[model samples]
Target: MNSIGDNCTELKKKYDSCFNQWFSERFLKGDTDDSVCAPLFKIYQQCVKDAMKVQHIEFKEIEGDVLGSDKEQKVPPKSGSSSS
Candidate 1:
């Protein structure tokens, strides 16, 4: 099941398919072009944004705070930091 909604499932699948193909064929082949899946992804993104709005989700705030932030967070040291 999609996290967005049932209405976006089909679009998500289509976008996923396009993305997988692009990743495997073009990306792996060192083709950095993103035109192939751009359209599909754009539509899928719009659908997800609309669904999130309907669910009262603040997509921009979530995205900005989670991903757009440049602050570097520290990772805790492992219990055993020494090499075996």
Candidate 2:
């Protein structure tokens, strides 16, 4: 997969590594502490946010306060209001 930020490919990879480890080692083990990958996630998120701005990607919040909550529900048909 490609990096979300143009210049932060390495940073993203580094963060991904940390995240995968955390998920398998801590989170799967019932550890909910987020301190392990907090710093790395911050850096990766900032880089991607900057890239999104540079690419003119309009960032908007979802009305239901959900991320990727059901693609069919989020996308409406041009003819009708079907939430299927």
Candidate 3:
């Protein structure tokens, strides 16, 4: 049982180490119409929670009112925008 726990911890570390590049690759792709990105996002969220658990970090609820809740939902604009 101890060994399994240690292995899981190490794997989580490796996952974290490679996450930046993996995230960039996934996020940089254009229009993933095959609908694969959602699962990757979920896995990334779970991995973050797992790592936080391993590190004994406490989470707090967010306090801000949700932004643009009344607007019709659409994909967020890319980083460079021309809107003035």
Candidate 4:
């Protein structure tokens, strides 16, 4: 998949390929250490962060949990429902 920043696509691809190789060859084999792709990931991450800054996207916005899974959500009672 292409990266959010076009300039980082190559870096992202490198990291993805490395991760895939590591996951299949090492992780699945019980060698769970993932530092093999850490450098590539860091480079790609920085590139994406730079692109986001250029586009005026705040880091806090991306940091938000859109799924709301961390907090309990109360469902409102349905209309016409009454306590017995």
Question: Candidate 2, residues 6-79: lDDT per residue as tens digits?
Answer: 68798888988998998999999999897888898898888888988888876773234555655435644578
Q: What RMSD does each model have against the real structure?
A: 5.3, 5.4, 12.8, 3.9
Better of 3 and 4 by lDDT: 4
Computed on alpha carbons, the lDDT of every model, listed in order, comes to 0.83, 0.79, 0.53, 0.88
Q: Estimate the lDDT of model 1.
A: 0.83
Error of 2 at 65 (Å): 8.2
**Candidate 3 local lDDT, 19-42, one digit each (tens):** 555556664675334344445545
Global fold similarity of model 3 (TM-score): 0.32
Ranking by lDDT: 4, 1, 2, 3
User: Which segments of model 3 are wrong by more than 4 Å?
Assistant: 1-35, 61-84
Better by lDDT, candidate 4 or 2: 4
**Residue-by-residue lDDT tens digits, candidate 1, 1-84:** 574777999999998889899999999999989799999889888988988888998966565454445554666779979856
lDDT for position 68 in model 4: 56
Evaluate model 3: give its lDDT. 0.53
Best by lDDT: 4
lDDT of 1 at 80: 72
lDDT for residue 10 in candidate 4, whole number 0-100: 91
Range of the 10 consecutive residues with the lowest summed lDDT in candidate 1: 63-72
Clashes of 2: 0
Q: What is the lDDT of candidate 4?
A: 0.88
TM-score of each: 0.71, 0.66, 0.32, 0.77
Instruction: List the candidates ranked by TM-score, beginning with the highest.
Output: 4, 1, 2, 3
